[model samples]
Target: MSTFPTSLTCTSLSFAWPDGTAVFDDLQVAFGPGRTGLVGVNGSGKSTLLKLIAGELTPADGTVRVAVEVGYLPQNVTLDTALRVDEALGVAATRAALHAIEAGDATEEHFDVVGDDWDVEERTLATLGELGLGHIDLDRTVGEVSGGESVLLRLAALLLRRPDALLLDEPTNNLDLYARRRLYAAVEAWSGIMVVVSHDRELLDLVDQIADLHDGRITTYGGNFTAYEEALAVAQEAAERMVRVAESDVRRQKRELIESQTKQARTDRKGRQLAASGSHGKALMDAMRRRAEETAGRNKHLHEGRLDDARRRLSEAEETVRVDEEIRIDLPSTAVPYGRIVLTVEDLEIAYGTGASRALTIGGPERIALTGRNGAGKTTLLRTIAGDLPPVAGRAEVHVPMRFLPQRLDVLDDTLTVAENVARFAPRATNNVIRARLARFLFKGARADQRADTLSGGERFRASLAALMLADPAPQLLLLDEPTNNLDMASVRQLTAALASYEGALIVVSHDMPFLESLGITRRLHLEGGELKEIDREAVGYPS
Candidate 1:
């Protein structure tokens, strides 16, 4: 900590990719001592900006200034499996030094290590418990927990360090509903300067304000996520009105220019007739002809200039009406009959550590939401249902055609183009058919030819969904696991709209309550304590 107030600011920041593509140019933004949510559509450079501020990614120009130390939790967290919990938390040395002193091997070196804060163990336990990690022992190995737990562990480490400023990117991606609640509580209790980049509605609602990064520009709005959206909706409405007015002006100007040009043509013909008839002296006729020619030229230039001005105004007005394109998934072939049995589970136990003994069945287009705590085997169950993993016992089956979109989105082949990836799922389909089908996912034209490795987070998700939706058999039963994890707000809306057109059975595993609520889920399943049962929406702490 320093005498100055905790702050993080950037001046004239500029950055570009190795491929000569620009992401930011001369961006100026300042963040003071308060919680701020950073939001924008995918590829808008929210994560890149955080990396620049945290010194992880250096800017090509300008500078990042911070009054005190900053702690950053990246979107993807990887820890050494060989390390112990204490070592991962950066407290191994201090804890070891304390143990030695307690064993009567007290030395000046030990004292230096312990410092004045001797209750490190108590603090560590409290922090872990706060993040729903109380069951984890200090000596536990990093490999012993689930992916979501590892994220919370890293967050706990940062919390105990108590840095002046904290930066979190997609912190709740892998967390379960319960774990997400814990993370939300931790965010609410944070008193220092913090900036979070996340699509989790609950977590974003805890922010003091929102900093929206759009088209390489930062726009600040007061209050939480809902407030920011309300404000944006109002602004977008006003911009649309301006666009209408400007368009009308452009049409009026074009009509006036055309009429004026026609009138001038008629007058020019009359002047030519008078000159040809020699009604006056040759000098007067020649002078009049020159005067008429100059006036016509002047009038033409004036009308053209007016039309150009009107067009320019229209263009400017259109630029102000910013909106993200939506993915269109109209799978008429995927529709299921009313009496069709889409999926069935009979006393099935996933190959993972957890076990479920309850029977389940999904008929017609019933949308099911699967939720549970971390390490509760949600992913395992989905994998088993998809036939990717063998069930420990009983049977898990899908009666109709199905496609699974895993949380990692690894189904895509990186070297192949978007159209090619979808083609892989439908090898018999022609390139023209694949590309035409891909347009529904918002990957039209050259975008459909882009390699999978080159796509942004949202684009990758959409491409994956496209591949699944356009498969040869046509997915009649779509199984999505954490589909909204890496998606931005706009992409989530696109996915929701796309799902509305699915016309088939769906079993989606996600912790995003708002996203689930919007899907018109017919039932909710909770898997925990070696049992799977139907739970009411209100029982899960959300409305229908």
Candidate 2:
């Protein structure tokens, strides 16, 4: 932790996609020294804002101002496989110069390159070690590392620069449990102006504050994620109450308007009767009728205005109540009978480069949590079970219809609409049937018509999940690999809700402990040393 006067400020920042989708409009936000956890539902522009601040994308209008140097770690990190660890860390040139000087070739240029950083190699190794990359050699190429390690390597590069302001977008998306712990520790130790966009609750719990980006605005809340949740709970409660009051007011106004209309109709009939009865002079009767008509019109206009106001209030109140849609679907077709063999892998070996293998059996509707370190072939095993890969040694037998949701979610066709994608999976299903089910997944009407490429991360996940769940014959054995990797809290909740209704045997490979526990896992298995070892939740280093 360093006491540096650093800040990140956005002034009237506005941005829109090329397709004319407006993300932010004249948004103004400022982040000073301290860790700020940026959270919002997917598609709320959290990542877009981070990109704008990082100067990766130019805002359509306004400006982003930073008081100090900045470092950014994007959500998807790609590294040149041929580049060495030292090159990726941006210290290769300096290290070369230092080596040259050490070799007694003390050229002026070499001295200039090595100036004041004679221990650059040591610092680089130390930083990598701090990020749990100590075993990685500086001379080793990036192709030798795992995806999670690559992310950490990128972060390590940024850490070596020691920027005053830092921004991280979903840094824990690909990290294993151990790597996530290291990242949490790093976030805890940071004291500069830091903003992290993530949906990992445990990671967010380490932040000094929470910045909720919603509806093109950022609202800052003091304390960690727990405190922010508490505040949100209170706000939602109040908003619900307001909605109720508004509903009552609207009902009352509607009743009054009806009563006024009825009274006016009665008055009109009475006036017509009086004029027809000739109880007064013709001219006097006509004048009285005119006066009555004017009064009736004015009263009608007043009542209508009141009713409109009440309706407007109700709409505003409803807007304040967050619409966290839940997936509601019945999956009785996916049910597996008790003692039924769902999946069996005997001496199975994945075809990937990782020499990992597994031997296991899943029965009934058992919920299994697959846990392992990064590069341990968890994904490879899942792919093998999904029939995407042939086993190098043995066979995997699936007794029932199965579906696998991969981390990349590339199962969808970007050129097709969401409904079309679902139809591709369940070809027999009529458009009406597909739409009816997609509505439960929250892709109603026009949303279902939206192209797969146009959906946000959360929306795409929902569409993919819908396609799997609605597939023909149903998925009696469901496999999800890192399902919650890029999902926001709301999407995760929706996923949990959808899974609750599923009566199938499930094998979920994930590092998200809380999500796994919420599924009521019947067994926890650790994939290590080419074997599946059953363990308890606590044994896997997860908080019980």
Candidate 3:
């Protein structure tokens, strides 16, 4: 740990959702100066804790103490499109004052506004440049920047504040490779109490330590994400070994208890036979019978106590084992014949307002990865193919049943439950059938009844995925846009597992290289400079 002073401290912090979902109860944690990666499975309250610390949500009990200024960047960032870049950066007034003073109209109020930030404009430009927004002019409207750039701009605003403590939630969710690199650099250069909640492995690797939030508790591990994983592997191995030992002990104790009972029964039978045969006087036989009865009761109690102790040990051991379930389903109907044409783009022009055009044909069950820099119209192309957007020119056609999983995952109705969402896609399927299929997605029983709006980032993604995959007419061609955007690592693995079972043609537009590689992408396409180009994996900047 760094020698810097503590910037944030939570003392017995407690919080719950309006629906009475308890997230944290008497949770306590402290962060000193240095970068800390906060990680956990989806819905494990990583984001919730950050919100609590950031004061975005109020706690029902306990206290959160922040000794310094705090800056927070939430998962989704929205800015007023009409606002100028400087205004969005929170430096518009100071910049204006400085300019007025330079122009010899130095009013006292302007002097007060300018204060000591006379170089605010230069500092703003420098910060923007550091975040790969050097091309963005201070006078440009927020509408001019792309979504990814908008996120960076928000972060730039936070940096400009120079808060002593920073909390970032999934900051790299929509960032492309180049933008991600810039964010990574900013993280590396930070020197303060920085707590980041993200599943980006590359970004997590730069942290000074890792904080794992699970089961309403936080466990700190010294070192980066890789080191934390190694340590966790060791702990899990030990826990599993203990569970095996405990199971064996329970079996042994059970056998011993049974043997003791059998021995007592045999002794009782022998005593009864002696007593019936009149081998001893009546008084002596009665006394011996009482003694035997007492001994049997004592032995039974001892054996029972031992058995209970063994079971307790087994239960404790089992609790130590982690439960990270993966989604496993077989969608054989989604398969396409080897020579069948699945989709064709005949000189199609996307509605990206950039006149980007592409002509392509996808056959069989090929998996295609669409990649490019931000603002390259990958999402627009996917939308056109999904029939949600009309092509500006030419024609895009799908020869088979198709489904689209958009980046926002807005397909599900907020008022509907997970099962209901699935049923919406598979209108003819019975509730029982939908429930069974949803169970494979890990939404068994009451989980299937959860409202779409109530789901965490990961759960929502799984729900959206389940709906698409469990449709009545199986989708032979699936179009996905940034499917892994806000998912945690475990959820990402679950998605990969689910896709492995999908034998359909796929066209995924994403910045996640690992996920594309996991899908065994048969082809790569890049949208660049207002045109589609077939490229090798290296051209897409993915490792071989």
Candidate 4:
């Protein structure tokens, strides 16, 4: 903890995109003295809120107040590749002053620059080691390390500063299993205020509380991810119960209205018959008929009012119930025989970011997970296997049809509609067929007409996945690279559901352990230092 209690408060914060899309309006929220895991669906302005609090974006209205110094690690961290490790840590000036003093140069300027902290170098090295960057040297350039290492290097810099508050947005995104554990440990060790926006389940489990951002408001839930989930489940159950009760009330109202109207109609018929037969005096009969009509009108109006009130209540109750739609994927055509050879690599020397290479041979409906340091070239190997890139030395041949979903999701044509993009892949399929399939992917009717470029991150992912899976030649071998990188928990669940229906061989390059476990990965392959090796469950942080 710091000398002062850390706090962040936002007052009547309002913000909008340049295109005039309002994200938050009159939002008031605060965070104080603890770890908060911020979570929300895609397009709910979770990232925007972080940016506003970090002062990266100016709010259209209102103010953000921080009680102390802060350090922020963005979702997509970019370090100057040419910068030295010490320089990136913001300690080069102090280190230089210390070195000067060590050389017996008794200068007042050096003393002032060094201040009272002379263990800066050792502290920097220690921070780096804690984050699994022990092999990295102080004078090493950022370019010499992998992308995952860059994220850690940036985090290490922040940790060394010892700011009163730390904000991390998706900090564990590209990290491998080993790196993710290191990050989790760091998160556990944090003693001051920290706010994290991430979809990684393990990282979220370490937070002291869960802050749910929805509809431009923040709802704080006490405890970690599991506790938040339990609370949410209870809330959902209550909401669902309300909906059921409302539905029953509406049914009862309709039934009562119909029954009352039927009884009134029968009484009016009998009274009219009596009047027509002249069973009473004309004035008496007329008065009786008038009374009957008035009574019937009153009953009808009362019943109608009761029915309307019931309907209004039902509508209000329904509005309170949340609806989370799921996708339905059934791709029987993509299935391969149990004994079929999906792919073969004979001495395949694929580039692994370094001068060396890796090789592999996979068959049947195998579910493989590729894990390693970020720049160990998992994406390169996937692309090479997908035939997007040529091999460095040997051959990687796919015995069955294959489709690759890259990190960029570039398989889609932004200019075309979702239906049209799927049509492009399956030219023989009719519009109706494509649409029916797209509906399973949750692009129904007008949504299928939406252009690929206009899709949200989750929507784009689903669209891309649909096109690849629903191609003319159904893919028997599917390659997915970081499929859940930026997806929300809902979208991740959607992906899991879709994969459940896929009967083909799967090769996924992801650092997400929960997701990988959900996929029932048959073999875990760790790609590192130009070698491909199979690892056990414990090696991937999930032990059976």
Scored by lDDT, the top model is: 3
Cα-based lDDT at residue 531, candidate 3: 79
Model 4 C-alpha lDDT per residue in residues 1-544, reported as the tens digit of each score = 5555437889999998654667899998888888999998866777788888889989999999977888999877888999988899889899989999999998999999988778998898889889989998888888888778888999999998889899999898778878888999999999888999998888899999999987788999999999999999999898889888888988988898899889988988898899888879999988988898898899889888888988888888877666765666778577788878888877767753443445567888899988777678888888888988887888888998889999878899988989999999999999999999999888988779888866656678789988988897988899999999778888788789878888889999887778898998889887777777778755636321
RMSD of 4: 3.6
Between candidates 1 and 2, the one scoring higher on TM-score is 1
Model 4 segments more than 4 A misplaced: 1-6, 104-112, 328-332, 338-340, 352-359, 373-377, 387-390, 408-460, 463-467, 470-474, 535-544
Choose 1 or 4, whichever is better by TM-score: 1
Clashes of each: 0, 0, 0, 0
- Provide the lowest-lDDT 10-residue window in model 3: 535-544
Local distance difference test, candidate 1: 0.87
Ordered from best to worst lDDT, the candidate numbers read: 3, 1, 2, 4
Over the stretch 370-481, how does candidate 3's per-residue lDDT look in tens digits?
8887777777788888889998889998999999999878899999999999999999999998898899878989889988877777778889989998887889999998
Error of 3 at 133 (Å): 1.2
| Candidate 2 lDDT tens digits, 21-62 | 688999999988889999988778888899899899999999
User: Of the candidates numbered 2 and 4, which has the greater TM-score value?
Assistant: 2
Model 1 regions lying over 4 Å from their true place: 1-7, 17-21, 60-62, 272-279, 415-420, 444-454, 536-544
TM-score of each: 0.90, 0.88, 0.95, 0.86
Predicted structure with the largest TM-score when compared to the true one: 3
Which pairs of residues collide in model 4? none
